[model samples]
Target chain A: MAVSVLTQKKNMPAGNPVERLLAATADDMARVNSLILSRAESHVDMVPELARYLIDSGGKRLRPMLTVAAAQLFGGGAGNAVNFAAAVEFMHNATLLHDDVVDESDMRRGKPAARMVWGNKASILVGDFLLGQAFMMMVETGDIGSLGVLSAASAVMAEGEVFQLAKTGDLATTEADYAEVIRAKTAVLFEAACEVGAMSGGADAAGRAALARYGLELGNAFQLVDDALDYGGQSGALGKNVGDDLREGKMTLPVILALAAGNEAEKAIIASALGKADASDLEVSQVVAIFNRHDTLNRTLEKADAHARTAVEALGILPESEMKTILADVVMHSVRRAS
Target chain B: MAVSVLTQKKNMPAGNPVERLLAATADDMARVNSLILSRAESHVDMVPELARYLIDSGGKRLRPMLTVAAAQLFGGGAGNAVNFAAAVEFMHNATLLHDDVVDESDMRRGKPAARMVWGNKASILVGDFLLGQAFMMMVETGDIGSLGVLSAASAVMAEGEVFQLAKTGDLATTEADYAEVIRAKTAVLFEAACEVGAMSGGADAAGRAALARYGLELGNAFQLVDDALDYGGQSGALGKNVGDDLREGKMTLPVILALAAGNEAEKAIIASALGKADASDLEVSQVVAIFNRHDTLNRTLEKADAHARTAVEALGILPESEMKTILADVVMHSVRRAS
Candidate 1:
């Protein structure tokens, strides 16, 4: 429900979905933000030098905000929910540092990636330091239930990353296999972040499960939209280059769905596009054209909408709150992103 | 003292220092061996395949053996100690994985290094996985006390690795800094393994403290020997090329001592050799000649011996037992190893 949480809070206009979502989650995030900043700042020597480059570089803080918003939505804030909200951001940033190293990426949010500026070793170690810090922060919460959830999520996230590496450039990847990897790599953390939020929020088992399902669906939708945008999202808004994933030989949901139902010629073009890790813009355009011709974008969007609808439906059991409406809107916010 | 902790009691032979020490520690090691083997077997996926590979290559399992030996010496059992021992090996292997990446070396323990075989990303993540696994195993103990000791030791080890990386190729390195780094990097794990063993065995604080001190001194002596061998040990026997550390531009205690005492001419040679990471044996030999001329080798041995003696001295208060004697002889057994 904390849609564009950081964006909404930092620069709110008189009225908009971004402002409404940010305004809705403002009180909860204020508490978590203070702790998040302090927790991150505690490792100043390890994180500050390059972290400011990334953090101050301006990320959405979407995941952590989801954590705090989820907690507040559940009407429970007496526990360590705020601390955990901050902890999730630490974990996310840690993975980002390591990912930049693995991807050999040079830019993040228009600034130099940690590896490009501080070297790969620093990126790797600082990433590690953040991971350790996240673990330490979670342990301080003294919530054994949340601890188990977070650790398992951490392991699953690593497994997903490994699986993705092994499957790169393999055109025969199944939707099921790719979805499983995506669940592990992306959804697990999001799902667990929400689950932990609910758990710390004093939600019952059913409530927690509902929130977890919602998070999983949201994550799927987010990644699907991301893939669709990769070939055409505005360079200035999305923060990632179009065609980067395809160039890296990755087949996202749109590409997967497109190739599955497309004609032979379309499949051939798709295969060729993913073959080169540094494919030209012309190749990217051809693939995008095929996507449009085959209606893969609409198909993929339907699948994403199904997930988002399911997420909102899962929240039917919860008592109505302004936060729930915000959460409901997040589904479309990501799917309808301009950039 | 439960010298024969795992298998045949008669395997606890007592004669010459080296053979006797080996025999005395062999039973406990048998238990640790199986646990490490089984843990590696459970994860054979291509992602962590390098982790299994590096582990299966088998570098004597010395660190885990130290844990086992310490447990038995402190009257801890074979069964309960196995996981702790496994934890020690996990940590050691984790360090090796990271170290190989840092050194960019192509070989480890007579096999292709993790970085060489699986690339830097795999090596780094697997290293992180092993560290996480170590903590997972520690958590099984359900003893927060054990968690505290292990986490603190783990952090120290990480700090040491960072310090070593920072000091790489620095000719002006001092012995104190060298000791600090090793203490964090290697000695703390060994020391913690022993102290935690005593703690698990229900030993009083005084007893655990004494054992930890003993392990600390022994580890220092052991690494000093390792440092010594890096400069002077045979290639095949050492399971690493001679001057391997020097090839990584490492400044060991012998080099530090020699550089400190040698005239301007010898100091210049040391700097020149470090400039060449692949410096030949003849080049290393010239540096060795300088060390011999300055008598730094003897000084290094004398320094190692002092630590060994201190390790032995710390055990004076322990009750008389065969395990005690074997543990005491670790000083001599450690420093005497040619490689």
Candidate 2:
């Protein structure tokens, strides 16, 4: 425990996240972090280099936040969400690191990916290390329903990834198919995000289901918006390259919706553009224009609005608090972000 | 249960593997084709297409055999080794799948690597799937020591991979460093093989430790032999090209020992062969001749012999039995083959 002082902040930040959250969720966050480090400590000495590299990478801690918050929302226990949060975060990062290794993508946010910095092998093995660690965390939670949800969700996520890989670069994907893929790929995290919250918060069956539904809908909208931005936005605003998704041959919602609304000539043109390694800048511009014409951007925004409304509705069972407002804001950010 | 009659083997082989391992691990080579289809059945719909495709593609299954035989040697328990066997097998395959993806390796055991066959993303995620499944299985063993050995070994194996990647083509690898890598990379599984067995079979502390030492030494020799053969054996016999490890810039035992023994001229030859993508046959031949003259092959074999002997020595704690003989023969075969 002497080592804990080294990591503890001498001057803690001003914002009180747990105080803002329902049922002392900020305290829950502190508790979760402690458990995560403790659980990870078993693996720490053995992989001195990788364990240090990955944990110190400073992830945003969004997934774990959702876990604890959901638990608080329903006015139940704090400990369950802490474990769920740690476990879910572990699973999330594991996939991200592995995704980088497979895509050979060089960057994560603004920094180099774990694979780029630590090499692909550590990126992968540490990813695995986290995955196993996640299960241990889940088991510690001792909630069978919670376990069932997380396990089933994780399996589906893997399948979704496989489906995405199979369809990548192919122009045959429809808006519906793209929606399904993104739902599996990204929204499940959102779903887990909300469901784990309520489950840990000790919401009754109907209440917990409501939060899960909210999370599922919100997650779907969030990913659709992300796909749209990855295709349509500029790097200056997005902090990443536009059309990076297209370059990888990923047929996102904008592309799929645009094609469905376009004439045959336009469809064929878009298909040809996707096939080219160097589809002209002019052609890419034309596709973007077609998306605008089809009102795909507006439609995506409308869906996001629906998810945000649903996200708030899911928490209706909870007594209103400042933390509740933040959850609503997070949902807004998920679906409504422009860049 | 109905599926067995549905998916029944067309021609099941006679004789349990316990009876055949004494003939040499090589001669008994074939799929046990059990536990996998049943245990992974929850993901069964995808099994034929996704899970089974790469698994049945022909792997050594050495880890599982080590697990099963180790348990049997100590005295059987009620289906305990079955879980241990499944756990080790899953861990081994998980490593291979991730390894193939990271290494960009196209072939494994003379067949297409999982990444090459199913695409890298599937290989990566399925590897995650199996890993999650492995932890789930190991937990059912109801022994914390079983969980401890398997999880710790998983961490070590992963770290070994990271170390190997970091040290690639670095001429500084000594025998001790190589030994550490091999212990982590290979010996940990061997140790798990024996530890899991002893625990499941109700062996006492002394028996368990002795068997664990046997597996650890056995794995070390097994890896040493594999490394030596990568440089010296026929491509046809090994089912991979000679010096494939060198081609990939992997610093194995022979290469490290050879480099340590070589003069400036010999070192120059090895560097030229390894660093170039378009490495010429003439350059490779020159390095091979230098290795031949340095007696690297003989020295490597001697080391393998010493490890194999140590493995057998560890088994001295066990009472004389048919199981012990089979395990002893396995240690002999580990280093006896030229390839």
Candidate 3:
């Protein structure tokens, strides 16, 4: 098995790692997608309706795909991976629903957020429904260790959100604080997703730790790039309006770096626009110009690249495999999306 | 043990069944309380702040008490009950936080709702955090069976909330629909709480099933009386304004009964008040007057009494014990609260 995987890695496909991971795990993910939809179903019409709306919405299902890939990396394609993958997706979707409500975001995936369409109350409750369903799926797997990982991740994710909420609109928000926020909110789940998937795949302790480290670093890179993209990428490509993080007063790395380096006038420009829901396009452009002047966007991308490198390096301890190679490339691809 | 319990039951001294249950389970409950507080703590200031506010608020802690009592009833209380009990309370509090946000309720336990003080976003997030913690605690117990019970209960509870949301302000709601909603939203958790408590207490299958049935019926009685009290009980006693259900457009048994029994003119009066955020005291009184004319409040109470009777009867198969007696009385006391 090891020799075959090593042979495949030498002639790896030269395209998007995400697409490759998807193709490799398509059969497993097919089961995962079905389980996700089936579990999201409820006797209550609105639950399935709202859940399906968000589930079918254009999320790359990247998190779940990573779970499958990690599991497959460990020679695991047994049924447990499918359950963990579905649970991970539900956790992600649950966060998205709540985050939209928290950020008061109008758009998600270039469509009106579920909160906007169904109202915040529905969004909040349905988010909860998804979360409850997530735990239920995990419990069904009867994998207490993985359940522990995911549950702890869920709590940390919520803490990250609360911490971010507390720091919103505070210009004194430090880069360290921003890092903690992102690590808690985004990267921790990635770490758990990969770790749990590896566990499901029957990875030994060392292999599990390596995948966890890889996932954590990759998640950090993934989020850093996303934060950067929020400012630098086109709205169409990002599937969310640029300046949303700014408008939500999210103290992402770009804003943190910009605030650190900006002069008094530039700082004033960013402050005026920060957390202002109705901050006009012109005002946002002014903030963006200051960010450009400070080159904070590029600087953020640099940090993401560093994390991506660490993520790939984390994979070095593992034996060569097509899935492992694909995982490494996915990390690089995540960072490169900013460019 | 059975003989000692039987002796105590013959000489049982109790004024209120709730107080009796509390005293009986006091030692175990202290541990459960501590677990609840410690688990609710987070490094993030607001997470604990909001959680403490809700936890410290004057909730009767009835759900957790039930868990403790049920465990004790089955000749168990080694340690698992404490975890299950705390998890039960967290689940209850999580739902309370979310329900307040969804209902736009201003008051809970005679204080400003957590949403009112900390904002809906914090409530939603903290609620999620508590729920995550709940699952984490359950995972620690490593009891997959209990975890399954609790997780499935959580999903059912969410479904109940959504079902209730959809039926809100719909005058066409039937008693059967109302029963389903309450079962999902309220009774299901109670059922699971007792069942899991029994499991942790090392109960055999029959005992577990009996306790579960007792809990379900008791929960039904509890909610039925609560709904009745929403209109008939005083604000101070209820810890919330009377007619809250009416203003929130909750189609409880009382409302469903009143609607089915009211004349055209009375129906118009109810339709005007239903779902009206600013429903005046006079308008509420007019609706209450219609309920009085049809005796819908008492009718609801009568339904509660029936459930309470069944709850008590479910315990008949168990060996005679003080805890069993107290459990039966608590069910009666729960319904008696309406008067």
Per-model C-alpha RMSD: 5.7, 9.3, 4.9
Cα displacement (Å) at residue A257, model 2: 2.4
Tens-place lDDT digits, model 3, residues A234-293: 221323377888888888988889889999999999999999988887788888888888
lDDT of 3 by residue, B76-138 (tens): 854798999999999999999999989988889888999999999999999999998999999
Candidate 1 lDDT (Cα, 0 to 1): 0.72
For each candidate in turn, the TM-score is 0.85, 0.80, 0.95
Q: 2 or 3: which has the higher lDDT? A: 3
- The better-scoring model by TM-score among 1 and 2 is 1
- Please report the interface RMSD of model 2 to 1 decimal: 4.0
Q: Please report, as a residue range, the 10-residue window in candidate 1 chain A with the lowest summed lDDT.
A: A1-10
Q: What range of 10 consecutive residues in model 2 chain A has the weakest lDDT sum?
A: A1-10
> Residue-wise lDDT of candidate 2 within A1-339, one digit each (tens)?
112211322443334433344334567778877776776553224344555455557765767787777777667777678788888877887788777776677777667776776677778877776766676667655565676677667766766776677777767777677777878878887788779778777787887787787778777766767776765542213233665666677787767777788999888777877645566667667766676778765666566566666776777776777667667656655554553
Clashing pairs in 3: none
Ranked candidates, highest DockQ first: 3, 1, 2
User: Model 2, residue A245: displacement in angstroms?
Assistant: 2.1
lDDT for model 2, on a 0 to 1 scale? 0.69
RMSD of 3: 4.9
